[model samples]
Target: MIALLSALLQGCALPSLEGRSESHALKRAETADTALGRALMPQAQARPGLSGILPLADARDAFAARVLLVRAAERTLDVQYYIWREDITGNLLLDALSEAAERGVRVRLLLDDNGVSMDAKLLALDRHPAIEVRLFNPFSVRRPKALGYLTHFSRANRRMHNKALIADGQAAIMGGRNVGDEYFGATDGVLFADLDVLATGAVLPELSADFDRYWASASAYPIDRIVAPEGTAPAPVPHAEDDPRAARYLQALRESRFVADLLAGGHLPQWARVDMVSDDPRKGLGLAEKEDLLTHQLQQVLARPPVASLDLVSPYFVPTAAGVDVFSRLAARGVRVRILTNALEATDVSAVHSGYARYRKDLLRAGVELHEMRRGAQPQGGGAGVFGSSGSSLHAKTFAIDGQRVFVGSMNFDPRSAHLNTELGFIIDSPVLAQAVTQAFDRDIPASAYEVKLDEGGGLVWTERRDGQTLRHKREPGSTLVRSVWIGLLSVLPIEWLL
Candidate 1:
């Protein structure tokens, strides 16, 4: 019964691990040394500015940054994104890129093949002479059924989820924001309240190198390959050498919401700055090493016993027993350690919530402040609401420590993110950025989350706030009748990797 229930819980799983063929191996081999290697090497330095971490709170800010970089480009513009839609946000940026390309700026655009849906305008932009667009891990699910199935197996395992942009071989944007509305707070229903750093100075070279490695990678397919069937006209290569108006791309970007945020917030010249230069990108570093780095950072932060507080605001919280122990040690030291994650009813991925629910009692017993975001957590600061509002979910992944250090990025506190997915983040030393993000976390705590509390009768209950009303509900969903049914029915599935 337990096996059957586990299997049922793994329903409709996406393929997470797939064996690689020689062809795939050869492709990776081709780009590994050439592309990944170049991104790690140092390059000529650019003149310094007020180089520090600039917080991007809206889509307009992100868009504006891209435009500024593209306009400022003299030699090259290397961009790598997980998804670049042809939506309003995507088109505006593409227009900017096209303009830059016409001005003789070498623009190499690389994207993950997973999320890009076919659009005529995007295909046409890719056909531009100056712009060289490539898709990482190319697959053709948009085609006929035959092609989709064949391509399906090809994309079953690896996924390119990195998002970065570099311009003039000088400056770069690296963080969680992808080239999409939701990521940038421009989407209608679900704007992701995300974080990214507009890093200048030494970090630019490292960022550029990262872009280059992916650009020359074996998985990269030229934009021309992002085509349609015989009936569809080949996307026109607009703005050839004869077209001299690509210069306007910069101006268009300047007028966008992206730039307005910078100009309005003074994020450019204002804000404390940090100049970081990494001689190597993590490609040379193994996954286990990255985990160790995170462990080290956490240990460093928790080294001194604190009487006050610890708060975690990760959207996905799936800590292993070892991770739980770390928090327990902190609690033992009298630190008020608290954690926030999505509730099962409000979670977008139920399997992840299932994995997390397994640890609720352990976490609570260790005196960790555990919170689960309730549905309909309203969007703050023009950020989008999670879908199913009235039952919206939590999507932000962040962690704040000692009201001082903060880490933000695409990384989810999950086994997949910690081990499988390649994640990147910054250790913001700025108290200001830390406070801003922490405050954001606190604001939502009241209306959108439930505090995990133990009753005097040794029962677990979740006290939540909604619609200006506080309500206490059973944390274990009261009856385990459904759980028992599920355990008996869902345990025999072969979907662990997808989860």
Candidate 2:
């Protein structure tokens, strides 16, 4: 019966990409006269071969940067992401894109099919002459989208996990953020402690070029090709002033100095040799060579083993046996390897936690340090620091090696990232940014996360510090017994590769 259903679904396959017109990113020279380009030119000239980097740790500032860039664009905007929610922030950004299109700016939006649903609003956006929307590896059967996975499991499993926003070919924002209320801290639900960087100069061209590759890849299907036209675009969501939850974000935007500082050349972006590493877009079709994968590129970039310390942060940390072995060897060599991931209660995906939980003992036995972010732990800087809000989950994927090198982007330390998804990030040769991460590990992380250790009897224990006192828990802190039992059951399954 399943085979028959799969065959029936396969018969109604995806639309052809035969005559899809090709497009490329606007060249720096083509956009040099635009406002953003003109404003950024002097800084680029001063830096020459180096890229300027401004870390966007604050959620509001991050959202503000993208919207402000869209408003500032005069020539083009190339946006890509794994997920784009239709929440307040999402609608606001989409409205900003439409406004840009109205000003004659060409906007290209590329989203992963599995991450979004095709609705009338998206179809309406695609109808705009200046806006083009494409989906990466889309589903043929829009309704019951999960059926696509059942019919074409091998193809549907691989995904495009890259996230980027480029404006006028002069500046770009790339990192781990997706467009959503949770990502921007507008929701009272589980917020994601994420990170992103605003980059210009030498990195912008490369980043734009990478977008073109994915934009033109075989897996990219125009929205019109996948979903038929529906109702007209709905009226834009009311302004932030109308929504109580979003009003705070409006105040944040007004208070943010990133865009203003950047335009006036006062942002003081750290100039460094930054390299963008990404999996080939062909990876979505399972056709990319092993050497073209982001994993291989990252390995090449961080070839030298850390002599002092390694501070790694990932929300879904399912380090398989091989990763555990690597960390164990590093610890054995006197390297202080520390890792931070979401605790059971803090994690949104419990199944992924199971994959990580099964390997906890091996990691502790090998002297590798582990920290789990506590639910409702307020980070420093009013929830704008490396960690997030009073109630949040760790979603940032980043690490610093020896306080000299730093990596930030969408790739997580898990089998899914390494093998299944096409990811993107940057390897920055900047001690300033790297040390900031390491310093957070030393200070903020301890206050916001629980330290996992082995007790006298070789049993696991979670240590927490609160109210100037130390507290200990024998089991996973803040997790229920039933949840722990379920995790134990899931941990025994041989599904680590799918994590």
Question: Per-residue lDDT tens digits of candidate 2, residues 1-499?
Answer: 9898768776659888999978899899889999888888788988888898999887777898898889999999999999998777887888899899999999999999888863667777887899999999998888888888877888899999999999999988999999998888777786888899989899888999999999999999998898875546552334434666566677767877866876676767899999889999999989999999999998898889899999999999999889999999999999999999999889999999999998999999999999999987776554456543444788889999999989999999999999899999999999999998998888888888899999999899999977778899997776788988898899998888889
> How does model 1 score by TM-score?
0.70
Alpha carbon lDDT at 414, candidate 2: 94
TM-scores for every candidate against the unseen true structure: 0.70, 0.95
Off by over 4 Å in 1: 1-50, 67-75, 119-123, 140-155, 185-187, 223-233, 236-261, 268-309, 379-392, 457-459, 466-468, 475-497
Report the Cα lDDT for residue 148, model 1.
40
lDDT (CA) per prediction: 0.57, 0.87
User: Which candidate's TM-score is highest?
Assistant: 2
How far does residue 54 in candidate 2 sit from its true spot (Å)? 0.4
Q: Which lDDT value does model 1 have at 195? A: 56
- Model 2 error, position 355 (Å): 0.5
Candidate 1 whole-model C-alpha lDDT, 0 to 1: 0.57
Candidate 2: global Cα-lDDT?
Answer: 0.87
Candidate 2 clash pair list: 376-390
